[model samples]
Target: MTTTTTLEPVRGPFVWRGDQLSGTDEWIFRLSGDQIAELEDAGRRFVADDPDLRFVTAAEYPLPVCADAVRVFGADLDSGRGFVLIRGLRMDGYDDTLAAAIFYLLALHLGEPMRQNLLGDVLDHIVGVSDKKYLEGGLPSRTRDKLPFHSDSSDAVALMCLRPPASGGLSSLVSGATVYNEVLARRPDLAPLLLEPWHYDWRRQDPNAPADTYTSPIVSWTQGTFSMYAGGDMIESAHRYPGVPPLTAARKELLALVEEITYEPGVALDMDFQPGDIQWLLNYAALHSRTAFVNGPDRAHQRHLLRVWLRRDVDRPLVPRFGKHVVVAAPDARQVGPGDDTGRFRIADAATIRERWGD
Candidate 1:
């Protein structure tokens, strides 16, 4: 679906680089000791009622302190700066299940969780599973591979650290606004091209999904609000479909410029994660990536994170193409799953995750 109305050039004000972002703690929230206690107590009660619980259920009983933070965080994710980090959760004695429960609990207040894959997974385990079989083609989340700068299929994407890798796995985040600003400065002709729609691969889609591909643009703006939906990996893979329009020379150049800008020093902020750290990025305004990680000789030291993709009650205005880019959660949907299945995400241990899916 394309718009026929001629739109003017968009030059938004949120554009910014790492030098301007990394120096400030305005985006960081360090939990106080009282808040930590509040969370631990909440987890105890939650697990008692249901040891294996999802966020939707845990959210029934709220932590007053966390409730306040989630309110402000929701605002920031949409308007202010577009990213926030929650710190100081003591991870020393917590189990993966409990930590995930707490993380998911906080996320419920931010927005409803979206299914992360066609398997109908609501909660995602960001750990490399033994299955590398799907990586040859599909957008499988279980891998040690590096992720290109991209956004997820939701209004906001979140991850909570469970284990720190022995090496690598640092997160690199770049602002779409910053990249757009740079493009406007260097190649004004490319600015408008970014507004045009391009098809994306449906690798993460289940066999039961409505389509094998979807269309969207890298940047979208309404009035003064700016939104972006880019997944370099997915865009490149879309070309495999003969019907999808190929990237023209100018489009290719724009893609290359995005890659270069995301990697250039001082442009993207690279963060080394701690076990208790939780990161949330506004999908529209931020693009993030991760380096390939290595596990220590001891399997216990392997890296892992819990991931959640959310759709807020309040979200930015989107281009017509956005319908294909984001998956909206149903109000009565009790469990998070794909359009075709009843799947429950189960965390087996700190090192492994188990989910029910029929391949």
Candidate 2:
């Protein structure tokens, strides 16, 4: 594929200092007591509307089809960043559940109405402070910690903040397409590396698996649209392969260039979430990351967020060489071996797998 390195023009660094971000006008729908109750009733009815309850595309269920259901999320503001956080929607059951009951209900309503599976097992997969290795090699280590902007395996990803770190753990996002344009303009030579298949370490895979390494591309395009899954740890893992062509200096410089442009204040959008707020993003077109976060004073109050990955059928196709095959719905769906438990959820400790999961 031809390379285009011009980065898109930067948009506003819209900061939402507390209350300003939670107002009704910013969302597509803001539901209260009676309205929320009505939504619950409607959700149950909608669940029964489709017997099979199979996943559907955004196009399948037009705006008017679930107009009321969509409104519960809020006004659908275009901050150029297609996302919104709805504060305190009520969840009638499981009050103490780490995930706000209202968020779960809303997820179910939105997911089901869109014909997307409101996967219970998948949703439960990454809730609370369970296992991180079960997801992606537990989180990467400090030195190799930077995550280049990329989308996860889903149409839209939602996170409900039950807790926030006292410091750090800031969420950052960039428009993947915008970054692509930047690369095209400022560093055209390196843009093709994004399309080339490179290696990644499935940091969350089973220890017994023959190899922890895998390969995929940084960016993929279909019908002129773009999607990405660029991660530093994954790219570094490729170096282990003997005889594999080394990443040229130009490639390295290009990557560093992309990183610099994408993370700049004018191009990057940052947000700090609070308890009771549910934030959702259209992952297909946006790249997201979280700065290193320190948990609260105690384990019980440690930084916690409920994550969900939803597959939206309307998005671009996965590039063949990237190996986009998915065996499970959520990150934690992988089966754990006899001694693979490290008790640590961070990927930095991944090197200790052999010692921890001794034969």
Model 2 spans > 4 angstroms off:
1-29, 32-35, 38-82, 90-94, 98-102, 109-121, 124-150, 203-212, 298-301, 315-318, 321-323, 326-359
* TM-score between candidate 2 and the true structure: 0.63
Q: Could you give candidate 1's per-residue lDDT for residues 115-210 as a string of tens digits?
A: 666556667777655445444642345666777888877778899998877799888888888887787777776778778788787744545556
Quality of model 2 by C-alpha lDDT? 0.50
Superpose all Cα atoms of candidate 2 onto the true structure and report the RMSD in Å to 1 decimal. 8.9
Alpha carbon lDDT of each predicted model: 0.72, 0.50
Candidate 1, pairs of clashing residues:
120-338
TM-score of 1: 0.87
Per model, how many backbone clashes are there? 1, 27
Judged by lDDT, which candidate is best?
1
